[model samples]
Target: MFFAVIPAGGSGTRLWPLSRAGHPKFLHPLTGTDASLLQATVERVAPLASADRTMVVTGVAHVTAVARQLAGLPEENILVEPSPRDSCAAIALAAAVIAVREPDAVMGSFAADHLIVDPNRWVETVRQAIVGAEQGLLMTVGITPTRAETGYGYLQCGPLIDGGPLRRVEEFKEKPAADIAEAYVRSGRYLWNASMFVWRVDVFMAELARQQPELHAGVTAIAAAWNTPEREDVLGTVWPTLTKISVDYAVMEGAAEAGRVATVPGDFGWNDIGDFHTLGEVLPADSSGNVVLGGEGTEKPGALLWDTANLVVVPYSNRLVAALGVRDLIVVDTPDALMICPRDRAQDVKKLVDELKSRGEEGYV
Candidate 1:
């Protein structure tokens, strides 16, 4: 049996108003379904990993909400971080804790906010990854790129290992420029780096010791005291001293360069839903290509659109939002804030959150 580790840390500033610091995107049901993203994620992996074997690493502020959402999971399974330290620390902490219990356990780290349309295919792909992980290969599931998406990173794949589905990861590329993204898609040699990883706890800890010794040491110390009364004291003392970095930068990139990483190509429909534009593309749309969310169960319709093409409106306040003759626009109406921007400019929504912080408008943000 394999363990599932979910690193649910991001505040999702890019999806502001709907996703706030107090209530992040993972807590909201952006998908048409009623289940929140984090809950959906746990359910998706339930077939492979039972609730007892799954672990969630989240911040102190959101621990209560996370526990409430995942009520079936044991309280100890919900790992809490005192503060934000990025993916490397969060994932490493979980890995260390699992290592203490079972050193050779095969664990997969998945993001809480990503959506996989085809759960069966996703499970099969992860099964393949687990097979590779058991062979001592650090496995990462790479999505087969459907379009020239500049928002996600890319993984350059080499020849298939042992003449099979598993391929050697040649390089890990950051989010490329428009031309480079287009070129990558056209080449068909690159896969979107979805940050999905699988490996044995011992293997991952060995790699962590080799690549990021300081981070490995810090997490190891915390894990030692995780079940003891000194858990909080150890986490508070050592977490801040650990280097803050993403797992991609601190481990995967270097491991790939050293030919220690392998990837399984997954064609299952996957979307990170990083911004409104991406969410609109994935959600159901009307005949005029308009996507409406929220206010559905209420007395009034969530949105009323006429002659609106490719518009995304999210009226969370249960107020009817009526738009006429609007094309390629995004309207997000919350109780305290209303954001109007072109659909193409959805990626820039984080700028609005930053502006609110600069203006000392924390309530709105």
Candidate 2:
């Protein structure tokens, strides 16, 4: 059986006010639709696997919220993280949990907020990754870069396998400068590291045991308590102590460094949807070069970008946001806060969050 894990434990502080601590980005309607990012992701995987086969991993703080967001999933499948550690611990815990009943099942772990327009192609790509995993290769789906995106990490494609369609991942490169990102794009040998992974529960757990024993041990205990009354209790005791590390830094990069990983080229209009600037590429812009998401019928919510272009405006609370004499800016409005920033500087939104922290504005974030 093919099982899926959706990790939804992110703060999404960059999209603050709209995306608060209690309600994460995945739970918000990021695409200007009624369904949240988490709901969309779950629906995308539904055609590939049943609801019973899908598991969502979120924090204790958002347990009720997550449960409400993904009501389609069975209550027993929602695994709550007692505390935030990182993707390494999250996926490790998922692998351990799924392995308990289906030791040989293929489990695909992915973030809950990614936007991939083509679900059919996504399922095809995931199916290929599962096949690769079944053959004892830890598989990752790499998106062919459509532009020189510096905000995302890239992977160098190694030589093709003798008979397989997959290729070895030469190296993982950090986000580079615009010029460097352009150069990497021109090289025709790199792919955006999308972080979607597929592997047998046994294979994943074994890899964790080899590369991250401490995390593996913690998850092992959590898995041992699966379907038991003490699962949540034990998780609360061990989760906070786990280190905060990405699965990329702790496992994938390490495995690639050891030369035992494979990549499946993905070309299904995939976007991690990490930042507001990326919304421009995902959403359809109007003839005036502005993306407005709001309104219902003739009086539907709408944003008026007068004398402005190349901006994304997501208006919440039925508020009309008007922009005049502005270009390349992001105007996001929520019930409690409003943010206006240049679209080019969208990558620095995290800095804004830090600045708020310095000013002791914790609640705003």
Worst 10 residues of 2 by lDDT: 293-302
Q: What lDDT does model 1 reach?
A: 0.92
lDDT of 2 at 264: 89
| Regions of candidate 2 where Cα sits further than 4 Å from its true position | 162-164, 177-180, 295-300, 304-308, 323-326
Clashes of 2: 5
Per-residue lDDT of model 1, residues 27-80, tens digit only: 888877778889989998999899989999999889999999999999989998
Model 2 TM-score (2 dp): 0.91
Question: Model-by-model lDDT, in order?
Answer: 0.92, 0.83
Which residue pairs collide, candidate 2? 294-301, 295-300, 295-301, 296-300, 328-343
Distance from true position, residue 11, model 2, in Å?
Answer: 2.3
Candidate 2 structure quality by residue, lDDT tens digits, 54-80: 999988898898898788889989988
What TM-score would you give candidate 1 relative to the actual structure? 0.95
